[model samples]
Target: MKIRYKRMHLRWIFVFGLFWLILGVISITNDSENYFNYGYLIASLFYFGNYFFKSKNQYLTFEDDIITLNNLIPKKLNLVDLKQIKRSGKDYILRTENKELHIKTKFIDKNSLKDLKAILKNLQTN
Candidate 1:
C-alpha cells in the first residue's frame, strides 16, 4: 500500500509560489527598485523548483512488512522489528531497537490517515 500526501497540502505550495511570483512580476513591471521583489522572485523559484522535484516522491510505501519512506532521505523499516509506536504531537514515531522513524501525519490525506492508523493499530497489537 502507498499512502499519498494530501492534495491540499501540495496545492498550498503552488498557491503561495504563484502568489509571490505574481507580486514580484507586478512590482518589477512598475519599475520599483525594491530588493524585496527580487527576493520574492527568487523565493518563488525555490518553492516551485522544490515542489516540482520533490512532490512526486512524497509518500509512504508499505510492502511485505517493510515500510519505505520516500522522502529526501529514503528509509525502510521492517514492521516486525518495530519495538514501539508512539504519538508525538501530530507525528507518529515508530521505534526499533536502535532506529526511529517519524511519520508526519499533517501531510497525509484523511482517508490515508485512517488506513495508516489501522495498520499501526495492528502492529501495536501484535
Candidate 2:
C-alpha cells in the first residue's frame, strides 16, 4: 500500500504567495524601488517553488517484506528487522537492529496514520 504525505499548512503558503504577488504589482505600479518589487516577486516565487517540490516527493509505501520511506530517497527497510516503535511528541521513531528512523507526524494525516499503524501491527505479528 502507498500513502501520500500531507501537504501540511498549504493554505498559509497560498495566501502568502498571493499577498506577495499583489504587493509586488502594487510596488511596480507606484514606481517603487527595484529592490522592493524584486523582493516581493522573489518571495512569491519561493512559495511556488516550495509548492512544486513538496507536493510530489514524499510518501510511505509498504510492499512485500520491505517498507519504503519515499522521502528524499527510496529507503527500503525490512519489516522483519524492526525492533521497536516509539512515538515522541508529534513524531514517530522506528528502531531496528541497526538503525533508527524518525518520521514527522505532520507528514501523514490522521487517516493515513491509522493505515500506517495497521501495517506496522501486521509487521509485528509476522
Candidate 3:
C-alpha cells in the first residue's frame, strides 16, 4: 500500500513559495541596498525546490514486511522488529528498539490516513 501527502497541502507550499518570491522581488526593487531581501529569495527557492521534489516523492509504502517513508531520505521499518504502536492526538508513533517513527495525520491524504489507521490497528491486534 502507498500513502501520500495531501495534494492541497502541497499546493499551499507552492503558494507560499510564490508569495516569498514576490515579496523578495518587491523588496529588491524598492531598496537595492538591503541584503535581507536575498534571504527571502533564498527561502523562495528552497520552498519551490522542495515543493516540486516532495510533491512527487513524498510517500509511505508498505511491501512485504517493510514500511518505508520516502522523504528526502527513505526510512524503513520492519514490521517484525516493531516494538510498539501508539496513537497520540493526530499522530501515530511506531517504536522499535532504537528508533521511532512519527506519522502525522495532518499532512496525509484523508483516504490514505484512514487506510493507515486500519493497518496500524491491525498491527496492534497482531
Best by lDDT: 3
Candidate 3 per-residue lDDT, tens place, 1-126, comes to 888889998999999999999999999999979898899999999999989987777668899989988777888899999999988998888999988888888889989988998999999999
Residues 59-112 of candidate 1 have per-residue lDDT tens digits of 798999999888667888999899999999989999999888999999898998
> By the TM-score metric, which is better: model 1 or model 3?
3
Candidate 3 colliding pairs: none
Q: What is the model-wide C-alpha lDDT for candidate 3?
A: 0.89
TM-score of each: 0.77, 0.67, 0.85
lDDT of 3 at 71: 74
Candidate with maximal TM-score: 3
Question: Which parts of model 1 have CA positions greater than 4 angstroms off?
Answer: 32-37
Tell me the TM-score of model 3.
0.85
Please identify which of the two predictions, 2 or 3, would achieve the higher TM-score against the true structure: 3
Give lDDT for model 1.
Answer: 0.86
What's model 2's lDDT at 123?
60
lDDT of 2: 0.73
